[model samples]
Target: MQSTISYLWHTDDLLGQGATASVYKARNKKSGEVVAVKVFNTASYMRPREVQGPGRQKVLVMEYCSSGSLLSVLESPEHAFGLPEDEFLVVLHCVVAGMNHLRENGIVHRDIKPGNIMRLVGEEGQSIYKLTDFGAARELDDDEKFVSVYGTEEYLHPDMYERAVLRKPQQKAFGVTVDLWSIGVTLYHAATGSLPFIPFGGPRRNKEIMYRITTEKPAGAIAGTQKRENGPLEWSYTLPITCQLSVGLQSQLVPILANILEVEQAKCWGFDQFFAETSDILQRVVVHVFSLSQAVLHHVYIHAHNTIAIFLEAVYEQTSVAPRHQEYLFEGHPCVLEPSLSAQHIAHTTASSPLTLFSMASETPKGLTFRDPALDIPKFVPKVDLQGDYNTAKGMLGAGYQSLRLARTLLDGQELMLRGLHWVVEVLQTTCRRTLEVTRMALLFLSSSLGTDRFSHVAGRPEIKELKEASELRSRLRTLAEVLSRCSQNITETQKSLSGLSSELLKNRDQVHEDRSIRQIQCCLDKMYLIYKQFKKSRIRPGLGYNEEQIHKLDKVNFSHLAKRLLQVFQEERVQNYQAALVMHGQRMRMVHETRNHLRLVGCSVAACNTEAQGAQESLSKILDWLSHQLLQDMTKGVQTSPPPTDPYPNPEPTDLVLHMQELCKEMKVLALDLQDNNHVIERLSRVPTAPDV
Candidate 1:
């Protein structure tokens, strides 16, 4: 009897019993259609196979069939194939149609035997055969091997029985011909009412069946012969339809079957192709379409960002405004105007207010719009006609907004670039450190070896030989190491200098924005006017009397103060120069000491290896000449230029003071002359050190 379980089809009654599994009839709660749900015995049956292997885990779900198993149908006296032509044709067509659907969807009903097929009886009691028992069904391409012989003995393929069930790792290709062969066997069985390759009621007849399928010729040679003769034919003893199909239509089957019965154990066709051929109804539903949408969004962002950057560049150039590193706001500062007397316009006429007050303060307004309390900006500035070119202003503002967006993007890109640079520099530093350590080790080994006294035993005292070789190669190694070290240092210093320069660029930008020199000049002009007004009020004529004398006295006082300030400035400048000189002197001394030490080491090393007297003498002479010209000349010149101290220690003659004065005067005169000549010499020097083209 059929039973209901929520919305699913189920059975209250058991349909069949087996050693491994049990089948029951079920009814759909909504449609009341019958279905068979098979419950597998967990201990007896192996698990559902994985793509890699098999275990006992799979259960079958089926549909109820009133006509029972194909085996039972053939065994009954009335239904057994003493073969009525129409009945045979109908059964063959039903089997072929179901198999075709499975194959097209890339599913393999690997076990296609009589016991597995069931015939559904309609309300009118007419039987419609359908393939069921999907428990043994597997994806055709699954690599996992199911070890057990799964179906009735007669339908097993010869190759499947003989060969390993699991495909080898190297086998990438498979076709649907294996399933077709099983269908052929099923067709032959239905017509003959006997298992094709095996007989029943024999002693363990499965082994004989396996042998026939594997090695012996199939009993139905006539079937094969008839199929070859007909071009393409079905196995039905009575069928009007032809079995021939186009190659393209046939090619579509493998992937189709692979989809539905997709034994996940195998390489199954993806859902994309499965749904496409499921039916015309399901073809409209698309899966996994978001990938295309994301690509489109990515493209739009890049294009919009680029357009914004170009617009910003154009605006910055046309307006003669340097691109601001920080955000810009036009509404932060507002303009004010200086008061004008005898003005017909701009003055507010109030009967209660004094005309003189209006005349006095008419030059500037007390307040205006768009002022920040944090910043001290001028009350007045020259204003532009912002609304005059509304269209142009609109265009420029649009461009400016674009620039702001692009600037943000650039900031992010710059951060990434800086991070990349940091990583690269870190790697370079690591490499340099390793190289230095290796060179140090090599040098230590060389030094120890070259100190050897051995003469003939080179191989036994290889360390000594190595040392001698190292001594010979020391100059080349030192030169190469120094060159590389200098290059690395230069790269580091260049990066540091670039960082400093970038900071300077920002500083310059701030300075340009904050410049109020023009406003300061106007303030000064106003102050001068105030002084003039005071002078006029006092009736102080500059050309006559006490007023002129007082003014002249004030002017002299200002001049004396200015001169004193100038002297103070000069004193400060001299102090700074002295400190700078001391720094330079100390640096130079250290450099000289290091150079001398390096030279002494090299000289002693060469002397130790001086087997040739003439070569040693020539090297010494060249070294002496280089030291004399380059080092001594610069040192002596620096010493000569330094002045004597001002502190007096001994009772000296006034003549000493006189001589000191004379020396100072003479040196000043020579300094002036040198200064006159230095410009031309510097120009010549600049032109002389031209880099050679590579």
Candidate 2:
């Protein structure tokens, strides 16, 4: 290793070696510019004095073509099939330019093969293939001929192969057209990754057979034939699916291949023609090719005036996937191709990224997709106006659920409230009515005791209302009725504040009812229960000695008012929550109505695309069906218009075919038609020609 002059060089870092010179990678010390040096084999020592004596100059740092030689690239697993149309163009441009320069200076490259070609990365990141290893090249005119044969056996022309390999005694001079054959073979290997002609045995061992295969073929027929070890000859014209060339590029390339792959000297295209064709393709057309799977690939051509519709049509033609079946995506979101958008604009916008394709049947296509960020399916995005509704729906549903649940709990307690009210009414009726009956009996007894048959109680039945005690009872009844009437108010005692209010109720215990202890309330209830236990004992006890204390306790608690208050509490607790649930339910219902309206926009988008695709399918089907029907009608007319066979075999059905010639009793009739009619007959009959059923 040595760092000398203006560059650092390493002896072991050999780039490549040939019969004349060996190339090495080097770097300039001042500028740190990397370059490939082509040093003559004998001139191993560096001499920076002269350019011809071979001290090559480095202008700018060039990125080494990590792809190595064309041969190594073809041998790679990815290029096992070969270079696609785009990369193939790079090779064509470089070789044709190099060849043109060499030929213009009266030099011929006798050896033009994959190994002799080298590549470098251009400033634009495009591959720049260069024709290198010019050891076998020499100065020669177009008409001048050379006696010695050179080049790889597989890529060599038949004349050279026969003279060199077969050791033929005859001498033949090869002209400059020999290089054209080698270039043809090289281009074939570049595009397809294999030789154009092959046999069961190797090229050198099967010398005579290789010669016959090459020479016997017609001019410009570039189909490749390969003889397998145990199988028959396999000839193929279509390039492999792995070749990532666009449809436009492949179409342009086939003709170039045909013109150059010819054996006849007069038929091949010159370097001038090759350069123009490759240059036109590289500058004019912009085609993008995509691979979907191991087997499926598509090439979509883009142009200035083309629309999205035009672009999809090209995709459909190449991939056989219908537009409806294909789902394009951009930046990880579904890409809805806009019908009116310019395809060229989209292609340019997405030129830096790879595009991915998905089948309608796939859950979602993955990996990559090329799509413009601005492109979308119209109205597919969520509407901002409706977002509020969507966001609020869940809260409404939850609130409604809680409200209804609370209403159910209150309802479950309703049965208990009704039962308590019925008991309170029974207690009130039994005690009050019995008190009046006993007082009437006492009044009658007093009236009989007196001599004058007069009673101390002087008031009549209607006038009993005038008594102070009666008035008092009437006032209590009126208060209970008024309180019961106000059902909406929360009249029940507040359990939380009852402790503070209990002292007040105790101070005026006769007037105000407090929630007494269970023992106190139970004593009153038990006294009433005892009366009902015995049939005779169940009679009303009222007045002075009729269990007065028990009755007074029941009276003070105001059972009737408590029952009404309890019912009011139950109704009040449920009504608020139940009504709230309804309101929330109403909110959700309105949301559904609004959502349905938004869904119509989505449905319209779907329907339009579906209808368009269906219309196209229906149009094609209708045309095919119409054509079939027309042919059938024409055939039916022809069968009817033809003259009847005289030898019908059965002298009956005149239009029938006569198959039994021996049974025919008369001669057959023949019809002569005009030239135009004959052509029409041929056309009409061709549609229904007799064919074997598979």
Per-residue lDDT tens digits for candidate 1, residues 43-67, read 4435334321244443455656766
Residue 222, candidate 1: Cα error in Å is: 5.8
Q: Model 2: how far is 191 from its true place, Å?
A: 2.7
Q: Residue 647, candidate 1: how far off, in angstroms?
A: 99
TM-score of 2: 0.40
Considering every candidate listed, which one attains the maximal lDDT? 2
* 363-465 per-residue lDDT for model 2 (tens digits): 2112111121112101212322223322222222222222232233333222212222222222222322332232232223222222131111221324333
What's the lDDT for candidate 2? Answer: 0.47
The ten-residue window of minimal lDDT in model 1 covers 289-298
Estimate the TM-score for candidate 1: 0.28
